[model samples]
Target: MRKFILCSALVLVMTALSGAAVMAAKPVDNDGDGVTERSDCNDNNALIYPGAAEICTDGLDNNCDGLIDRADPTCTAGVCSDADGDGYGFPADPSCSYTQEDCNDTLASINPGASEVCDNGVDDNCDGLTDTADPACGTNPHASNTWQNYPLDCLSCHDQQFNEMADSTHYWWVGDTTEMANQNGTLQGKLTNSVNSYCINILGDWPVCGKCHVGRGKRPDDPQADKTNIDCLACHNEDYAMARTRLADGSMAPSLAGVENPTAEELQVLDGYTQNINAPTRKNCLKCHAFAGGGNAVKRGDLSMSGTDLHGATLLEGTDNNSDPNFDVHMNVMASDLKCQSCHVFQNHKTIGRGSDLRPTDDLARGSEVKCVTCHAGFDVDGGHAAAGANRTDADRHVSKVACQSCHIDHYAKVATELNRDWRYSHDGTPADGTNGPGHPELTIGEDLSPVYKFWNRLSDNYLLGDVAVIDPETGAYPTSRPIGDINDGKLYPFKYKTGVQPMVSSDSKLVALDTYEYLAGSGDVDQAVQSGLVNMGYPSTEPVEWVTTDTYQLLNHGIAPAANVDCAKCHGDLDLATFSELDNLGYALKGPKAQICSQCHREKNLKSDHPGMHNHVDKGVGMDCLFCHSFSRQEERGGISPCDSNATDFVDTNPFAHPECSQ
Candidate 1:
C-alpha cells in the first residue's frame, strides 16, 4: 500500500509540471509555421516580422515608394494626412469610411474638397459642397480664363500661397457647420440632407434653392454652370483670377477682364484653361481702420493679397503684400519684423485645412486670427450699418468680436451691392427710413462719407432749398427744402425728382427728408416689378428720370454736379453753397442786403473787416467750405462736436441761435 501511494504522488507532480509548460507556451498557431510566440514579430500572422519576406497584400504597401499601404492619406490612426486628408490613404479615398473617409462629416456627401457657399448658409457637399457634386473636373475656375463676380481659384498658379491659405482660418468656411449654422439655422435642412434645396427649389429641388448655390460659373439664367466654385480649382485657376490690370493710362484697374464673358467661340477656344495667372501683391493682411476705410468687407485681412504692400520693410503694418516686401502704406509700424502667422499661429488653427467639416463655430481654434473688435470695436467705432447710433445686439453680442469675414465670406462685395441703397439714411441706429435704406458711407467713419450715405436732415440745404425757401430775411427761416442741395447723395443720384410723398413728417421714426418726392422717389426704392420690367426690357432704370432736377438745378452744390454729396460751396464759402450758381439771376448765396449769414455769427466788433484788431479766423473758416462747417457736418466728423465740449450740444455753431433775441 505504501509503495502504491508514493507512485501516485509522483504522477501528480508530473501532471502539474506539464500544465505550467502549456500556460507559458506562445500564442496558438492553427497552422504550424515553425515560428513561436517568443521568436515571432507578428504572432497572429503566419508571415510577418524582420525576417519574413514582404508580399503584395491589398492591406499594405509591401514596397514603400512613399506610398502607404497602397492607399491614400498616408495615415496610421485611420486618418489620411495627405493633402486632402481623405482617410483611404494617399491614393485611395473610401469616402464613407467612418474612421477613414467621412468626406463631409457634417454633410452626407463623401467627396473630397468641398467649401461652404456662405451667406446663404448651405453645406454644399455630397460629402461636401453641401452634398452637391464637387467632381474633380468641370468648367473649372483653375482651367477657365473667364469668371465674373466669382471665386477664381487664385492658388492654382500660386501653389505655395494656396497651400498656406488652405490651412488658414481666415476663410471661416474652412471649418464645419456647427451651432452657428445647424438645427433650424438658415442652412440646417440642406447641410444635413446632403442634397440641393433652395429658396427657389427648381424641381423645387434645383432652382428653388439654386440661388444659394451660385458661384464661379453661375448666372441667374444658367443652372448647368453654377456650383463649380466649391473646390480649390474655383480659386486657383489663372483665367478666372482677377489680375491687377494696368490701364493704358498706367492706372491699375481692380482686375483684368476675366475670360468669363467670352463669346461662344471664345469660350470654346479657352477650354476652361487650367494654367498660371499672374497677379499683384502677395501681401500680408491689413487691420481694417473703422476710422478710415471704404467698404464693409475690405477684402484685406491677408495684406499679402493686396494691391499694395507695407513698404517700410516689415510685413505687419497696414497691408502686407509680400511681393513688394515694402509696399509702404504704414511702413514705419511695419518696420518691426515678425510674421503675423507666428503671432496668431493661424496655420495650426484647429480646424484649418479642412473642407466640409460640421463642427460648431466655437470649435475653431481661438487664437487662429485677430478680431475686428480687437482694435476698432472699442465703444467708439461700433455703430449701425448706416452710421447710426449703436443698438448693440446681434452684431454686437454674438458677432461683435468676430472677424468681418465671419459673416461676409467669399462674395461680400456683391451682397453689399444689393443692400447698398437701403442702408444710408440713419444717424441714429437701425437703417435710415425708406424702402431702400442708406449704408455706412466709407468702411471707416474717416474724413469722408458716401454721397448716398450723407443723411438728409430737417435743415435741408439741397440746391432746390434756395428756390423752395420763403426766407424771411429777418428770420432766415427756409422750411421747404430740396433733397439734392448740399449733401453728396452719391454721384449716382446727383440730381433727382422724388415722386414719393412721405408725409413731410413721417410717423415712422426713420424718415429724414429733403422734401419728399424730390429725394425719396429717386433714392432707389422703386417698385420691384417696375424696376425688373425696366431692366428686362433694357429700358434703363438707372438713367436719370428726373431730368429737371438732374439737368438744371443740379449745378448748385459744387457749381457743378459731383456724384457724391461732397458740397463744394458748403466748404468754400457762401458763393460756393449748392444754390450759388455764378450764372443765377438770384446771384447765388450771400447777396448784399442778403441777411448776413456771417453777421449772424460775428459781433460787428469782432468782424475782421470792421475791427482792425480782430484775429485772422477768416482763413480757418475759408479752409474748407460752408457745407463743411454746418451743424450736420459737425455731427458726422470725428471730433465733429468739439472735443473740448463736454456735451454734444455744447459745441458753438456759427449759426448759433440767440433764440433769446429771436424770442423777442
Candidate 2:
C-alpha cells in the first residue's frame, strides 16, 4: 500500500508541472496591450505595437512596420503650411506631397508663377534673384507702384507741394501764352486753343488727353477745380502714373485693369509705395512724357524714355543695351547725369522751360527760355571748342547766329518717332496684341532722323481753335504750327517736322480737331470721330468736311550730342551746300553776284572752288561782314569792326592772294 501511494504522488507532481508549462506557453497582455511579445515590437510600451499610429515628432515607429517615424506613410512630418493662400507653401518638405516652397510666405503674389519686378528690391516672383539682377527683368524694366488712398492720403504731409502744384501749368494746363506770337499776352494753353499735327487737338478729348494732366479728373482750367483735384501721386509715384484709370466720377484711380495678369512686382502692396514716397525720378517723369501721343517714343522726337542712362539701360523697345552717351551728353549717367528738372529748373512748381509748340509760361518772372549759356556760361569764349589738333573758331563764330542744339544734336528720334499720322482710316484699338491690323491713324515712323533746320526767335505762330488755317507755300501743306522769325532776327534751330491728314471745314478753311478719344474708346470709326469733334466744337455735324494735310514744326531740344561729335560738314562744307538747300532757303543765299562780291574783297574767283579761301579770309580776323556774300549780316557781332578794305596797303600786302582762283 505504501509503494502504490508514492507512485501516485509522483504522477500527481508530474501532472502539475505539465499544467504550469502550458500556462507559460500561452500569450500574455503586457502593459494591457493586446499584442503578445512576438508581435509587439516593444511589448513594454503600450503606445508601440503592430498597426499603431507612427509618432513623427517622437522619433518612433509606433506601428512597428520596420519603417521609423517620418519614414512611414502615416506620419505628417514632411507636410507644409500655406499661410498666404497663394496655393504655395513654405519650408518645402521632400517627404510630403505638396506644392513648391514660397520664398515670401507673407505675400500671396510672391509665388513660383509670378514674374520678377525690376528695381523694387524684392524677390517678387519667389526667384532666387531680386529686381534687376534677374534676367527676366531685362536691362530696362518699367517701374510700378501701389497705393491705398493716393492724393488724399498724401495731403497729410505734402500740403505744400499740393498747393504749389495746384497753381502750376501742369495742373491748370493753361497760363500766359507768353511765347505764342499770334496769341501773345492771352490766357491760352492745351486746355483751350492748342493744336498740333499729332492727334489734331485736345478740344473734344479732355477725358483721354487729361490722362497726362496732373489733375485728378476735371479739366485743369475749370474754375471749380482746386487743390483737392490735384493728383500728387502722378508725379510722386511712377506706377500710379502708369496704372491710373479714369473713375466714374471723373477722378483717377489706380486699377489693375491697366495690365493683364499683372505680377506682384507690377501691382505691389499699397503701404510700400505710399509710405516710401520720394521726389520724381526719370522713371516718374517718363511715365507720361515718354508715352505721349499714344505710344512710346511716338510724339516728341528728342524727348524719349531712352533720353537718359540714369538706370544703366535703354527704355526703348528692342534696345537691350545701355544707351550710348552720344545719344544725350547732358542726360547720360556717364556724362552729366542731369534730370529734366536740371534744365527745366522748377521753383514752386513753376517750370522754366516750354517748347515752342506749347503755350504756357509757368513762371513768367523766371523767363520762358532755356539757353545753353545758362549752364555753359563761357562756351563762346576762346578755347571753348579748341581741341588738341583742331581749331573750331569757325564754329564759335556761327554760334551767334546758330543755336547750340543746331550743331550739338546730330540726330533726333534716336528711337522711332511718328513723322506722320493719317487719320483717314481706322482699325481695332488693341495695339498690344498686334491684332489691330492697320491701326487707327496709320503712323509713319522715322528713326535716327536728321532734323529739319529752321530759323526761330523763341516765338511760335500756333494755329488757334478758330483761326483760319493757312497753307505753307513751301510745303504745300497747312501750317498748324510754325516758328516765327527771319534769318535777321532768329538763330538757326533744329526742328521735328511732323505732318498729318485731318478733317477740315471746306467752307471756312478751318482745321477740325478730331475726337481721338471717341475713336479709340468708342467706335473705331474716324468719320464718326470727326462728327463728334464737329459737334463738340459747336459746328454742325454735317459741316462740309475735307481731308487736308497739316504740318507742325516741333522744336528739338533734348538729345544734345557732345560738342566734339558735331559734323561740321553737315552745314559748313561745300559738300553740304550742294546737297542741302536749307541754308539758301533761310536767306543764306548770295547777296549779289559771286564775282562782284569777290571783286570787292580782291578779284574775280570761282564761286565753288574759292569758298574755302573766302571763309579763310573771314577766319583771319579780317572782320569781313557775313552780309558781304550772304543775305544776313553778323557785323554787329563783330563789335563795330570794319570789313576788310582792299584799298588799304596792309590789306593788299597781307591778303594779296585772298582769292584762290585769282592766285592761280
Candidate 3:
C-alpha cells in the first residue's frame, strides 16, 4: 500500500514540471509568416525575420541584426548626399527611411550640426522644440551648434522673411513712389543709376558699396536674379561694432575697393556677426546712415558720431528750457527712448518713411506716407490743450498753409553737417596723403546750422543719370537736387542745403560717375579707379571729365521740439505786422500802402497802408485799443481767433471797459 501511494505522488510532481517547460518554451507566430516567435528576431514584423533581405539606410532593421538604417552594411558608401553641406544625410528613395538626423535635407545649413533659432516659429535645428520652446535658444541669442554659414544658416528659419525683403526698397534700392514720380514711369533707385550729392554713384564700385548692404560677399551680377543673397546678421546683430574690432586697420574697409577679397584676419571679423543677433536697432541704422557721405556725419547734418545719448539722463527729464544745453529733441535717449524704427515702421519689409532726396514724390504710391498727422492730432477736444488753439477754428487755417515741422523743428545738423565738399581739390586717390585733410578732407562742416525754409509742392523735376543739369544762372552752379513749389502747389517746409562737386562729362555737360575705387577701397589708385568707373558706365575715358558744383536741398524730418505758444511779436513785427506771403496767397494783399482790405472791415473810408495798426482805431487815435479786433492770448484759448479778424472780439470778458465801444 505505501509503494502504490509514493508512485502516484511522484507522477503528479512530474506532470507539473512538464507543464512549466511547455509554457517557457512556447513558439507562437505573431505576424503569421510561417516563422515561430523563437525563430524571428522581430516577432511583431513578418518581413523582419533573421534571414530577411537587408535594405540598408532605410532607418529600419529589415534583416533584424540589431544594426539599423545608415549604420547597416547594405548601405553602399557615398549613398548619403549632403546637399546643404551641413554634413547630414537623407535617403534619395521614397521607400527608404528619411535622413535620420536631419529634419530638412534641402537646406545645407540646417541639420543636427546647426544651431537652433528662437521666436521665428520654425524648428531651425530640428530638435523637436520650436521658437521660444527650444532649450538650445534660451533668452539669450545662444546657438549650441557653433556653425556659421551666413544666409544659408539664416534662411533655414527665415525663408519667408528673406523672400519678403527681396521685394523691399532696402533690397532693390528702387521702387514705385507714393508721393511723386517721373514722367517716364521708370522709378529711380540708388542702385538703378541714381546719383546723390554724396558718393555720386555706386556703378563703378559695387563691391565696396555692397559692404554696407544687408548682404554678404558682394553685389550679385543681377539683383533680381539672386534674391537669396541676404545677410541676416548685418542688421540683426547688435555686436557688429564689437566684431569689427577684429579686422586689421583699413584691411576690410569698404573704401578699400582694391581689396575685393577678404583675408584670414578680415574673415575673423565675420565671426562677430554671428553673435548677439536681434531685431534692428538705432545702432544698426547708424552703421551706414550716420556715415553716409564716406565718414561720420558727412552726409546729413542732423546726424553725428557723438552717440544718440548726447544728453544722457537730461533728455528724459523733459524739464529743460531755452537756457539748457540743447539736445536732439526727438531722439533723446532719456526723453522718449525713441529708436529709428519707431517712426520708420515696416510693412511687408518696406519701410514707411521715404528718403526726401532718394525718391521723387510725384510718383509716390500714397499708402505708406509717413506724416506727422499719423501720430499727433491737430486740434484739441474736451479739456486738452489745443494744438492750434481753442476750437482750432483759426489755428486750423494754418494747417493747410504751414507744415507741422515748420514751427516745431527749430533747426537741424546740431552737431555738424557738411556744408560743402570739393572732391576735385581733395580727391587724390591716395588715402595716406589725405591732400584735403584728415577723415574726408573734401568736406567742409558747419555746426548748429539752421534749415533753409521753402514752399514745396512735394514734387521734384529731378535729374536722372546722364541728364545734363540745368545750370542755376545766378548761382553759376548745377541744381542737382531741388524742391519745386509755388503758392498754389504746397506749403512751407524746412530743408538741409548741401553743396558739393562731382564729375560731369564736359562734351554734353551730363553727369558722369567717377571711378572711386581708391576713395572706397583705400588702395590710393585713382587712375585705375577712373578707368574702371568709365568702363562700367560704358562711357569712353576720352569724354573730358569736368568737375561741376552741385547743390541739393534735402528735407529735414527730425529734431522736433516740445510744443510752446508762439509770441505775437514773431509774426507781427512792426506796424502790427502783415507782410507774410501766406497772407498774400490767401488774397489779403497785406503789403505796403495797400488799404483795400482794411477799408472793407473798418468804416474809415481811406486807410493808406496794409498795416494792422492802420485798421485799429486806437492806433489811429480815433477809437478803442488793438484788443478790440486782435487776440493777444494763446490762439487755442480763443478758439482759432485770427489776430486781425472779427473772431478776436468773441473772447472779450466783462473787464473789457477800455474796448467797450468797439466791442459793441
Candidate 4:
C-alpha cells in the first residue's frame, strides 16, 4: 500500500510542473501584431515587427532591428541633385541620410555649411533664415556682420555712414567756431582748446575723459587715429557705455569681468546683446550726456534720464518730481515725445542746432535754429499768444524782446546739477574711495532752481585754453565763458550759471588746465594736478600759481514748459523782484525818464499803474515806436510806425507816442 501511494504522489508533482510550462509557453501579443511580445522591439506599435519593411522617411525603426529607419541596411537612402556642385543637394529629403540639404540649388555659395552674407537679400546659408535674421549674423544690418574686426568690419558695408560720422563734431570733438564772438570764423572746439567751470579742461586728461569720445582709445585729433579707431557701438548700442572698461594698455574694451570662461547660457545672453543694434534713443544718448560731469545731471541742467520713457522710469524710481511731464513738454513720453535728433536734425551727420555757449557750428549753413517758431508758427503775430483769459497781445510783443526759453523754461535743473565745484575740498563718499584716495571735488548742487536771465544774440565769448584769463569788471569773477550780446541787439534768454575754484598761472594770468585725471588716478593732491597741468601747458612746474574763482553761463535751451501754464506776473508784476531785477541789471532799463516820455503823448501817467495798459497804448493803441523810450526799435515789426508829421521834430512839441491825426 505504501509503494502505491509514493508512485501516485510522484505523478501528481510531474503533472503540476507540466501545467506551469504550458502556461509559460502561451503566445503573448499585446499589440496583436501576430508576433510574441519578446520578439517585437516596439510592442506598443503594430508596424514594428521583426521582419517589417523599413520606411526611411518615417525616422523610426519600422523593422525591429537594432537600427533606426535611415541606418537600416534594408532601406534605400534617397538622393537629390547637386546642380551647383557645392556638394550639398537641393529638394531637402527627410529620407536622405548622407548629408545636409541646401536651401538654394542654383548657387554653390548658398549651401548648408556656408557663412551668411548680411544685407544682400539672399539666404547665403541653407538655414531657411537670411541676413540679419540668421543666428550666425552679428548685430550689423549690413554685409560683414562680424564684430571681430570692429569698425573696419562695419565700414565694409557702411562706408558712407562711417565717412559721415568721421567728419561730425561728435567724433572730432571740435569744429568751426562760427558762432563764437571771441573765435569767430576760426576752428575751435572742446577737444584741447576750450575751458569750462566743470572739469575745467581736457588737457592731459584724455585717458580718463576720452571714454565718452566715439574713438577707440586715442584722442579724437590723434595722428595715429584711423577708421578703425571709430567706436560704432557707442551710439548704436545702449548698454555699450556701461559695458566698456579701460584695459591695462589704456584702451577701452567691452568688459568681460565675470565671464572670462562663460557657460553656454551666459554666452547666449552675450550673443543677444551683440546682436542688438538700433538708432540712438534717449537712453543711449543720456548714457554720456546725462552723466557728463562725473555723475547724473551734473553738467547739463536740462538734459536728464527723466526725459526718456521706459528707461527714465527705471532710473527715476525714487525721484517722482523729475519724472513729471510738466518739466519738459517736448521730451515728455506722454506728450510730444521728441528725441534730441528731432530738433537738432542731422543731415549727413552734421547737426543743425547749437546753443550760444557751444563753440562749434556743426551745420555752417544754419539751415535751422532750434527755435520755438519751428513748431509754433506765427508766434511773432498779435494773436499768437492768445489764451482763454490772458491778454496775449502784450505777450506777443514781448516775443520780440524775450526768447521763448525766458518765459517757457522758467526753471532749470529739475534733476540736481552741479552749480559749484570746489577742488580745495575732497568728496567723502563711495565714488571718491579709491587707491589714489579721495580726489573727487566737493560739489554744490541745485535742483528745480530758477534760471539766471541773460541777453544773448546767438554768439558766445567762450574762453580758449591758452588765452589769458580776464575778470569781468561787473561780476568781479573770471569769466570762463559768457554770452555776447546787449539789450540793443539781443533778446532775453535763460542761462545756467556755474562757478568753480581753479588754479591760474600768476605769471601770465592764464587759467591752468589742471590734470584732473592725475588727481583722480594718483595721489589726491590739487597742487600735484596743477603742477602736471603747468608742465603739460609748456610751462615750468615751479610757475607761480593763484587760486581764482571762475564762472560760466551755459545756455538753457531745453525743458520747455507749456505756454498756457506760464505765469506772466513773474516778469511784469514784480519790477523790483527776480525777472525785472535780472532784466534791469542786464541793461533792459528805459532809454530816458519814464515820466517825461509819457508827458509828450498826454497827461503824465503813473509808470507802474496799468503797466499792461500803458504798453498797449504805446504798441497797439497808437502804434508808437519802441525806440522812443527803449534802446531797440520795433518799427519794422509794427509796419513802419504811425506816420509822424515831418515838421514836428521836437519831442516836447510833437506827441511821438501818438498817430499823425492825434498829434495834430
Cα-based lDDT for every prediction: 0.28, 0.69, 0.55, 0.69
What ordering of candidates by TM-score runs from best to worst? 4, 2, 3, 1
Separately for all candidates shown, the number of backbone clashes (residues 3 or more apart, or on different chains) is 105, 0, 28, 0
Error of 2 at 334 (Å): 3.6
Residue 151 displacement in candidate 4 (angstroms):
3.3
Q: Which stretches of candidate 3 lie over 4 Å from their true place?
A: 1-142, 145-147, 181-184, 220-228, 241-275, 307-326, 360-368, 378-395, 427-441, 473-476, 518-536, 565-664
Give residue 237's lDDT in candidate 3 (0 to 100). 71
Question: How does candidate 1 fare on TM-score?
Answer: 0.24
In the range 139-167, model 1's lDDT, one tens digit per residue, is 33344544332234443354564444433
Misplaced by over 4 Å in model 2 are 1-149, 222-224, 247-250, 256-268, 306-322, 381-383, 387-391, 427-439, 576-580, 601-610, 618-621, 639-664
Model 4, poorest ten-residue lDDT window?
310-319
For each candidate, give its TM-score against the true structure.
0.24, 0.69, 0.60, 0.71
lDDT of 2: 0.69
Q: What's the true lDDT of residue 390 in model 1? A: 26
Q: Runs in model 1 with CA error above 4 Å?
A: 1-177, 181-214, 219-234, 237-240, 244-273, 277-318, 322-444, 447-523, 526-664
lDDT (tens digit, per residue) of candidate 4 on 75-137: 434534554445677345676532777665444456787667565456778778888789877
Give the root-mean-square deviation of each candidate in angstroms.
Answer: 29.7, 34.2, 29.4, 31.0
Give the per-residue lDDT of model 2 (tens digit) for 1-664: 9999999999999999999999789686443457888788766555668977665434455788988744776655554555444566644678644457776543444677665656546676777988778888664222222354554666766699788887888887778877778869998777878888887788777878888887777886678877778877677666666667786666775665344576777556444556444446566777677777876678888767644332234455312122567777777766566656656756677777777788778988877887665445335432234211155545655766788888988898887888888886542223212234223566787889999998898889988888898888999999888998888888888989999888899999988988887776666667778898999888999998999999988888888777778788787666432343567778877665555555655654455443466567655544555654665556676532333434334333323323332223
Error of 3 at 553 (Å): 0.8
Between which residue pairs do clashes occur in model 2?
none
